[model samples]
Target: MSTAELRYANQFEIIRSEEKDRYLISQLSQQLDELYTKLFGLNNFHIYQPYLHRLSELLYYLTTTLSNRQTIGEEYVCLIQYDPITKRIPSLMRRLFMIFFRIFGDLISKYFLTTFLIRPIAEDFFHPKLSLQTIELITRFIITSIERTHKISFYLTGYYYNISKILTRIRYLIYSRSTSESIEIQSNMNKTIKLLSLCLCIQHIIETYTSLKQVALSISQHRNQLNLIAEEEKEKEKKIVSEDITSSTDYVRCPLCYELAISNVALVPECGHVFCWQCIHTWVAENQTCPLCKTNTTQSRIVHLINY
Candidate 1:
């Protein structure tokens, strides 16, 4: 074999069939990992739950807005995700209504007290038991106390009360708008990435399958050749007639083991000569050069040993 052919054979000499299959399997695993990471990263159920909650909140706001019959008065229409109602309401207005109603109910008591400061005092004055200055002072004190109590009760509960302030509400709204838009954009991007990953993963599977198929076919052919050689060897043993006559089998025995190994397999380095399978396999494992010829083996002619 020329230097170029020898170099070419060396490529196959190092990576036997088994190692190549392992390489393909490992590479397929890597492609699978890349595909999974792209498809499922943070875009899965863990993050979807928040959006579900947001949708529920939005639904509640729409329902409440449409039910305000006093304001809508049977002359309005609302359409939310195909659910049609005869009420006109926008998303922003619904958000405001929800913020107020959702927060106020939790913080304040659920009672409409009819008792007023003037009711008890009026009865006292009617009986001439109170002076005008005393009533005036008492009324102012009661009004002040009611206002303080309402504010203090709301703060003590710690039930999302921070948004009640004007600046906080504005900040909350801005944050919510940006966050919603970002979530939507991220969700879209995740979908696109997942689609692309699926395509690549399928392509990788096809390629890996092709590689494995070729390897399997090669292995099958090699086994068939070994079987045929074994049958021939058995026949030769059965007919040991002319001991002096030369035969083709005499040339194929391994110089190392000096006996016919499985298939009487042989390797032909660049020298265009043959050596036993055991001999050449070991020789090549240690060194690429042919033992006798000291040249790169030419695979073009060395491949067929069942006939040799």
Candidate 2:
């Protein structure tokens, strides 16, 4: 061999020797085999069972090949030990299968799991016994929560982006500006206040978003309970309406603000309290607590009545 080739061969042999001496590879192979078996057994009913089987077969082939290889110095052991023509095709097929599996796994776990499955499962688990009216209320609450989260996310993202841009501009200005006393003082003060305001804004947004998300999750989790309470409430309401049918100028008292109103009304759930839409909306916006018993009003929405 030429001098350069000899040097390359020596380095390759060193790498091979180091790798062979390490027990980590053997341990990893054993662990992988166990994992493959467990996964295969569990995933027999999966739609991608064939693909999984192919992956397991490929893994076994690779593991066996690696185990049988002799760590000879400076010699490149042929990775493919079977017939060149037949083995080549299976090897290529295995490679393609592995590539596709990895791509699909990444896409499903990264995007589909969070976006489609988890949220829906949570919603369904919480809202099992829902009537049409209750469903509408829950839907409105969820939509509002999601919209609020999105708005907060967008606002924070913009704020950070602007702050980063401003910092970059400030850095450039500092490096290029002449060192005058007045300029130095002004720049320092501007940067300090800018950074402080940015930090405060980010902190406030994060806290608000976290609070909203927790409230949404709580509402989602208790959807079944909420539905039951709503049903009980509707029954009580029917009785009240029957009793008030004979009165010409009957008005339901506003449960939240205690303001007497004739229009745009909503029913406070569980407690069977009646209130105007504007009163409930303002109360929910401020305290998120029932005016009577301090029950949560986080998921409450305005219900408009249609007079037939």
Candidate 3:
């Protein structure tokens, strides 16, 4: 087989292994549902009991969807049943729960999987059998994945909090603007205006929140695709490094210069490749050439470096 084909095969194997690891971690997180149920039962008596039950149902549905061939449409139907408009309570509560479900789904898939599943697999990939250079490359890939996931979560959480805050503010606005007039007509007008303001707020909140969420989700999805490609590349590098370590090759090649390592002096980039400073400085001066790929560097850009 061709070298590229061999590399591709190794990467596919790695991805499959990572997927299995993620599935196991997801199973473990499911165990937390019982604890969440107990806590809800103890602290939240009546109103939140239904919400807790719904959460459990959602979790069960998700597990089944992941583990087996079960369709989640039925579970979605169960969720929709929670949509009820009662007398005094705001109808917006139903909308709130819908948004909550979406947010929860995102968290379970992204943050929960990354933290519990991918992390351990990544750590294993960097263990003692791996050389320093291979370990550094894998570590850099893992860290980038983590930071991207974190930023996405932060944006999502902030969006929800902002929605909740807007709701609270609308409630306050209505309450504050309410006047107690003995006249029925005036009271009716005030009530109408209050309701109108609330409706407007709800509309604005939903529109703005949806727009922000779409942007964040799009960015996250794109980054995830890039990460998958990066993961495949890293796996290929790992195999090459492993082969080099076992071979009778004498001089350690400077990744930047692609020549014999002259100096014990090596500089590590934020991306974790170590090379002779001379090679690195020359590459940096020209533009950032990733010691390995000669990929253009943005180390001089403060914001890019800090954000990365």
Candidate 4:
């Protein structure tokens, strides 16, 4: 097989193996949760829910150790982990560290800390000096950058699928299985797969860029809102301007929005006052009265003045 074909097969297998690993973890977690619920009754499951992450991690640790393998999924997929330097299984210490790091470093930092610690504190502080959400966005952006870098590297070199593997100095190698045979992908199919991978990479890049843009917008808006003095001054100025405008009849502004140009202009039947149709409709939904004159009115009686 050609180099492209080999790389394609390896990428496919690696993704499949990783997916299998996730499936196994999910199934084990669900089964354990179910067992606990059945044993302790439904009402008591809430007590166990908080410790689910710890339990799952423990289960993973025990499973890996007892099975004498890196992971059940990798073994199932005829894949084995090896230290690139020694061309042998990683040492006990290294393996243990990798497992612990997966459990503590990735799981705890990403899920546990965010859920248990950061989230509650963030909720308590309505306007924090340093926003935890901004911190989270930065953290996520860093992780995404690393993952995208790893993905590009994987595409080019067909090496590590998991970032954790790269961090732990581990790589996957296919083990011999009599029943399983590596299929030779046709040149056309290989090209198609490459094209699809490129498309996916492009999509991922677009999504990341969009997320970054949204986060930037949100942070800017949050900062603006946090400026109490500026916000108060703006509000006071707005109130003064609005009072002056409303006091004068010369200004052809909609009372609802205080805008010079009224969009979809609608007249209140009882008050003979005009407003933006949307503004009036929204206003009448809660209070069925003209905003400016306080004359009784209904949404149905509001007339849209098209040419008038």
Provide TM-scores for the models: 0.21, 0.20, 0.20, 0.57
Model 4 global lDDT (CA atoms, 0 to 1): 0.70
Q: What is the lDDT, from 0 to 100, of the residue 257 in candidate 4?
A: 80
Per residue, candidate 4 scores C-alpha lDDT tens digits across 1-308 of 21221122266667777787778777778888888888887886877774775577668756784346667667667677778889777777777666676666654556755666545655675344546677577457656766786786776566777665676787777743322123334344457667866876887889789878976776776677678767899999999998886667434567768775333688888878888788889999899888887888898999998854
Q: Against the unseen true structure, what C-alpha lDDT does each candidate score?
A: 0.44, 0.47, 0.44, 0.70
Show where candidate 3 strays beyond 4 Å.
1-185, 201-205, 208-212, 215-219, 222-226, 232-236, 242-308
Off by over 4 Å in 4: 1-9, 39-54, 65-67, 107-128, 176-193, 229-308
All candidates: CA RMSD (Å): 40.1, 27.0, 28.6, 17.2
Give model 3's clash tally.
1
Better of 2 and 3 by TM-score: 2
Error of 1 at 163 (Å): 46
Candidate 2's clash total is 0
Q: Once model 1 is optimally superposed onto the true structure by TM-score, how far is the C-alpha of residue 242 displaced, in angstroms? A: 5.9
Over 4 Å off in model 2, which ranges? 1-118, 121-125, 128-176, 198-210, 213-226, 229-308
Per-residue accuracy of model 3 over 1-308 as CA lDDT, tens digit each: 11211111111222243355346545544555456666664455555645555565456545543333222332322211111224232345444454354435444445555556545664674222323333333344444444444333323222211232232221110111222442355456456645654665566556556655554464455556667878999999999997776463343466655665533435444555655556666667776657565555654521211211
- What's the CA error at residue 28 for candidate 2, in Å? 63
